[model samples]
Every structure is written in C-alpha cells, then in structure tokens.
Target: MSTVIEIDRLSKSYVVPVRGAGVRASIVSLVKRKTRTVEAVKEISLSVEAGEVVGFLGPNGAGKTTTLKMLSGLLHPTGGTASVLGFEPWKRNNDFLRQITLVMGQRNQLIWDIPVIDSFDRNRVIYRLTREEYRERLDELVELLELGELLSKPVRNLSLGERMKCEVAAALLHHPRILFLDEPTLGLDVSMQRRLRTFVEQYNKRTGATVLLTSHYMADVEALCPRVVVIHHGELLFDGKLADLVRKFSAQKTLVLELEESQEDLSRFGQVVSQEGSRATLRVPKQDTAEVTARILRELKVQDLNVADPPIDEIIDQVFSRGMA
Candidate 1:
C-alpha cells in the first residue's frame, strides 16, 4: 500500500493570557499581562498507509483532537510538518480538503431547522458533486446507516443518535479518500455505537478510504483498527498492532470458570474479579495462568473454562500509567 498520511515531527502549541482574581489585580493586569505557552501536540512523527484503519488513542487533553485538527487543515501548527495525500495539511488547499473529511462527535455542521437530507445537500454543493453522483452516494449511505426514514426529518427533531448518523453521512457525501473521526460515537447508546462502527467498517471496505480514528470507547478501536497509536501529554507512546500492545504491557490474564456448584470461594487460585451463580471470573498473573488453570481443573468441579487476555481498556490504562511514570 502507498503512504497517504505522512507526519514528520508534527507539533502544535498555544499561548494564553493569564489573569488573577480581584478588581485591583484585573485592572493592574490590563496594562501588563501574564501569558504562558501550552504545548498541545509535541513533536510526533507517524505514517499511515492507504486504506488502513488505525486507532488514535489518548486521554482527554492529550492532543488527539489538536493533532486531528491540524491534519484536517482546521488549525495551524506551531512547528514541524505534515503531508496528507501529498499536500501540506495546514495549507488548506482545496484539492486536499476535497479528498478528506473530519467528523467531530461534539460538534455539528448541519443547520438546525433544515432536514437532514438538506444538510447533506449543502455538503454535496460545497464539494461540487454532480446531481447523479450525489444521489448515488446518498442512497448508499442511507442504506448502510439506515437513514432512509431520518433524512426528511428536521435536524432539530432528531435525537442524538439520529443526528450523529446524519452527521457521519454528511461528512462522507463527497466520498473523501481519508477520514478523521474524533469521538464519533460519543454519547450514543450501546446499540447505536455498534451500528455506527458497523457502518464505518462497511464504508471503508466499499470505498477503500484510509481512517484515523480517535475514540475513548475501546470497542470501537478493537472492532475497526488492526493497529493503534497511543499518545500521552502530546507525545507518542506506542504505535503497533493491537495484540502486540496487549502482550507488551498487560501482566495479567483473565480466566472464566463455570462451576457445577455455586458460591464457592476461589481466592486461593487467583484474585476473584466477579462471581455469580455457578460462574466466576478471575484475574491471574500471565506467568501463572497455565498453572492456575490446571490446578482449578484438578480441584474444582469445572463444567467449562476459558482463558483469555485481560480487557483492552485495562491494558491501555497500563500503557498510559507506565508512560506517565
């Protein structure tokens, strides 16, 4: 695959005015101001290939949004360089903008009183799509997102989930080759989140658009991205396969056991995470997983048992904690 997104020491920063409380202090600060420089994105370099779905993972204020904004040509970087589709992102060229799209979960680009399809039409015009192309793409998005019923409804009348579906469709109306999704599933119910994830997967497969997604929901990352890039404090921490991240940082394994009898204490084998009628979940050291599994089978009445890696979120937490340390 060809490299579509190439970032070399990309960085961003901000300067903000500082002020203190009290009328006297505020008046005195009118003439002489205090200011500080905040680094939103430290020097970070990464390369993404065409048609790849890579997860961008970081906590709040970790510069995930800042990086995406810079890459989408919405913000100017303080230092370094980035090239998306062989165009400098901060330059905001029309050719570059036409080939990429950014969907922010917390923000909306649709007009409030207009119907969802009207908003999509607005984007269709902005991207200069022909009537037939617009209709074909709209139909495909409507079927994939199940937006046939919601399109004619006013944007104000739609619920958060419904509006989010429309927002994604509007962003993709032009069939951009690159997608920057920042928390696209935020504030949605479990079913809605799953639906959006499925739609994104289908869109990528159908269009072959490269995706750089930043989501707090681990399920989104696990489902869509084979590779993940972790950033903390505006610095790169890890960039590798999802399974490699788990293997490198995670120290524990999870064992799920189905007991023939209920209410049995299994603390001697490992740390009991949870237990219910005839079933228990344990967290055991990775090194001791095999031995504990055998011992549990030897001692307890086990109808069924399974061993698996710890949850992805837990492994990610470990990654951030260790990186901060």
Candidate 2:
C-alpha cells in the first residue's frame, strides 16, 4: 500500500509568557516579557499506509494533540515536513482539505440549535456533493449509525453519544480519503464505546479509508488499531504492533489463585499485588512462573489457579512511570 501520510522530523513548540511573583518583578516582566519555550512535539517521524488504522497513544501533554493538530493543518510545525495525500497539510489547500476530515471528541462542528440532518445538509453544500451522491451517502450513514431517530433532533437535545454519532456522520458526508480521529470515544459508556468502535471498524472495512486515531482509552486502541505509535515526553517511544508492545513492556504475568485457607501469606511466592480473604493475585516473573506455580501447588492447599498477562493499563503505567523516573 502507498504511504498516505508521511512525517519527517516533525516538531512543534509554543512560546508561553512567564509571570514574575512580586509587583516589581511583574512590572519588569510586563516591560520586557520573559517567554519560555515548550517543545510540544519533539523531532518525531512516522508514516501511515493507505487503508491502515494506526493508533497514536500517549498521556496528557505528551504531544498527541499537538501532532494531530499539525497533521490536520490546525497548527503549523516549528520544524520538519509532513505530507498528507500528496499535499502539504499546513498549506490547507482546497483539494487537500476536501480529501481529509478531523473529528475531535470535545469539539463540536455541528450547529447547536439546528437539527443534525440540517448540519449534514450544510456539509453536503460545503463539499459541493451532487444530490444523488449526498442522498446515497446520507442514507448509508443514517442506517449505519442508527441515526434515523436522532437526525431530526437538535444537536443540543441529543445525548453525548447521539451527538458524537452525528458528528462522525457529518465528517463522512464528503467521503474523505483520510480520517483524523482524536479521542473519539472519550466520556462514553462501555456499550456506547463498543458501538462506536464497531462503527469505526465497519466504516474502515467498507470505505478502505486511511485512519489515524489518538485516544487515551486502551480499549479503543486495542479494538481499532492493529498498529500503534507510542509517544511520551515529546518523543516517540514505540511504533509496532499492539501485541509486540505487550510482549516488550510486560516482562511478567499475573497469577490469580484461590486458596483453600484464608490465612496463608503468598507474598513469599511472588509479588503480591492484591489479596482479599482466600483469594490472592501475584505478579510472577515470566521465566519463573512454572517453577513458582509448582512450588505453590506443593506447599499450599491450592483450590484453583489461573495465569494471564498483566493488564495493558498496568504495562503502560509502568512504561511512563519508569521513563519519568
């Protein structure tokens, strides 16, 4: 597949003013302001292939939003180059703009007082879609998102999930070749989150559009993105398959055991993560899990035991925590 997005040594920085503490210092600063530079996105480089769903993962203030803004032409880079769909994103050319769409979770593009279908119609006009094409796409989106009941309702009246579906449908009206989704599933209930994920998967499969998504929700990353690029402290930490990340970051597996007695101390067996009455969870080194399990079985009256990988959340927490330390 061809490279749909290319970023080389991309970096973005912001100059924020510094305020002095005392009145005299504040007056001096006002006269000759002191500004500090924050490197929002350090020299980072990555690419996305056409028809690929790539997840961009990071903690807050980790440059995920800054990088997304740069890629979508909302903000220009301080250095380096980026090309999306064979055109420069910063230029914001008409053709390039028409071929791409950005959906931010906390931001709304729909008219607040107007009905959602009215907003969709407005997008049809903005994209200059033909009547036939507009109707066909609208019908498809309405059916796919189950927006028939919500379309006629004003955007303000709709629930968060309802409004999000409308927002996504609005972005897809023009059938853009590239989609930039920033925290698209934020603040949603589990069922709603799953619905949105299913819709995204279906949309990608049907349209074959290239998608770059940045989200804090691990579930979103695991379900939608086979490949992920992890960034921390304005640096690219990992870029590979999700499974590879799990294997690399998680050096140990979790063992949950149900003990026949409630008083046995299992801390000596491994790192005891949690204990409640007769049940206990331990983190054992991957290499010594077998030997440790055998020992536990022989030494204690083990009623039931199960071994599994550590939670992805814990692994990611360890990665960032260790990096900061």
Candidate 3:
C-alpha cells in the first residue's frame, strides 16, 4: 500500500494568557503580559496508507482535532513536518485542498436556509467540478446516503441525523482521496450513528479513500476502523490494531455465574465484581480463568456459567486512569 499521509515530529503549541484571581493581580498581569506555553500536540509521528480507515482515539483536549487541522491545512503547525498525498499540508495547495475533505460533527458547512442540493451545488462550484461530473457524483452520493426527500428540505428543518447525512454528501461531492472526520457521530442516536458508520465503510470500499477519524464514541471506532492510534495529553500512546490494544490493556476476563440458590457468596473463586442475588460477575486473570471456572463448578452449586472478555470501555478507562504508566 502507498503512504497517503505522513508526519515526522509534528507538533502544535499555543501561548495562552495567564490571569490571577484578584482584580489587582489581573490588572497588573495585563500590563506585564504573562503567558504560559501549552503543547496541544506533542512531537508525534504518524503514517497512514492509502485505502486504510484508521481511528484517531483520544479524550477531549488531547490534540486530536489540532492534529487533524494541521493535516487538512486549516491550522499551521508550530513545529515539525507533515505531508499529505505528496504535498505539504500547511501550504494549502489548491489541488491538495480539492482532494481532501474535513467534517466536524458539531460544525456545519451547509447553508442553513438553503436546500441541501443547493449546498451541494456550492461545493460543486468551489471544487471546479463540471456539471456532468457533479451530477454523476451527486447521484452516487444521494443513492448511497439515502438522501432522496431530504435534499429538497432546508438544512435547518432537518434533524441532526439528516443534516449529518447531507454534510457527508456535500463533503464527498468532489470525491476527495483523503477524508478527515472529527467527531462525525458525536451526538446522534445509536441507530443514526450505525447508519453513518455503515455509509462510511461502504464509501471507503467503493472509492478506496483514506480516512482518519476521531470520535468519543467507541462504537464508531470499533465498527469502522480496524487500526487505531491512541493519544493522550497530546502524545501518541499506541499505534496498532484494535485487538492488540485490547490484549495490551485488558488483564482480566469476565466470568458470570447464576447460582442455584439466592444470596450465596462465591468470593473464593475469583474477584467478585458484582453480586446480586444468585447472579454474580467475577473478574479473573486471563491465564487463570479456566482454573477458576473448574474450581467454581467443583466447589459451588452447579448452575449456569458464562465466560467472556471484559468490555472494551472498561479496559480503555483503566488505561486512561493509569495515565500511560
């Protein structure tokens, strides 16, 4: 696979004004001009291959958006280098801009008062697409996104989910080779989010567009991306497959048992995570799970037993709580 996105020591920093609580101190500081340096994105290196859908995972204020902005030529980096599709991103080459699209879930690029088709037409003019190309691409997007009646309605009248679908359709009118999505499914309902994910996966399949997506929703990451780059405090933490992340961060498996009798304790078998009546959940070391299950069945009342890995959210939470230790 060819490398579509590359970064070496890419970083962005900001100097924020510092103000004291007291009025006198605030006045004094205004004259003195005190500021502190903040590293929104540390020196992070990344490489993305063509036709790959990768997840950019991080908590809020973790520099996910900052990095995306630099990659899309919307923000100039304070230091280091980045190349997208063989062009420097900060230079904002017209050809480079035409081949990339950035979509923020909470932000809208569509005209609120205009019908969705009009906004798409605006994109058509901006990208310098001919009428025939625009019509073909628009037809394809409308079909893929199921934007039949929705295109005739004004953007302000559409629901959040509908508006998002339109936003995606508008962004894809130019058939960008690279797509940057920041929180694309942030506030939608579960069903809407799933639909958007499915659409994106299909688009990538048909067009082979390279995508770098950032989202707080784990479901979006799991559904659409096979590889994930985890970041925290503006630094890269892990860059690998999602399954590798689970294995690296998750130390235990889950064991659930339904006892024949109510109110019985099974603490001796493993770490009891939750106990309610005859049903109890246990956390056992991965290597010791089989042993613990055998002991539980042999020593305790035989009943229904279930074994599985712990939830992905819990494992991720543990990693964040530990702070990259």
Q: Which lDDT tens digits does candidate 2 get at residues 145-252?
A: 999999899999999999999999999999999999999999888998999999999999999998899999999999999999989989999999999998888889
List TM-scores for all candidates, in order. 0.95, 0.95, 0.95
- What are the runs in model 3 whose C-alpha is more than 4 Å off? 258-262, 276-278, 301-304
Candidate 1 lDDT over residue span 227-248, tens digit each = 9998899998889999998888
Clashes of each: 0, 0, 0
Candidate 2 stretches greater than 4 Å from native: 259-262, 301-303
Write down the lDDT of every candidate, Cα atoms only. Answer: 0.94, 0.93, 0.93
Q: After superposition, how far is residue 222 of candidate 3 from its true place, in Å?
A: 0.8
Worst 10 residues of 2 by lDDT: 316-325
**Candidate 1 minimal-lDDT segment of 10 residues:** 316-325
Q: Compared with the true structure, what per-residue lDDT tens digits does model 3 show for residues 1-325?
A: 9999999999999999988899998899968989999999999998999999999888889899999999999999999999999999989999999999999999999999989999999998999999999999999988988999999999999999999999999999999999999999989999999999999999999999999999998889999999999889999999999999999988899998998887776777788899988889999999998899998898889589999879877887888879785
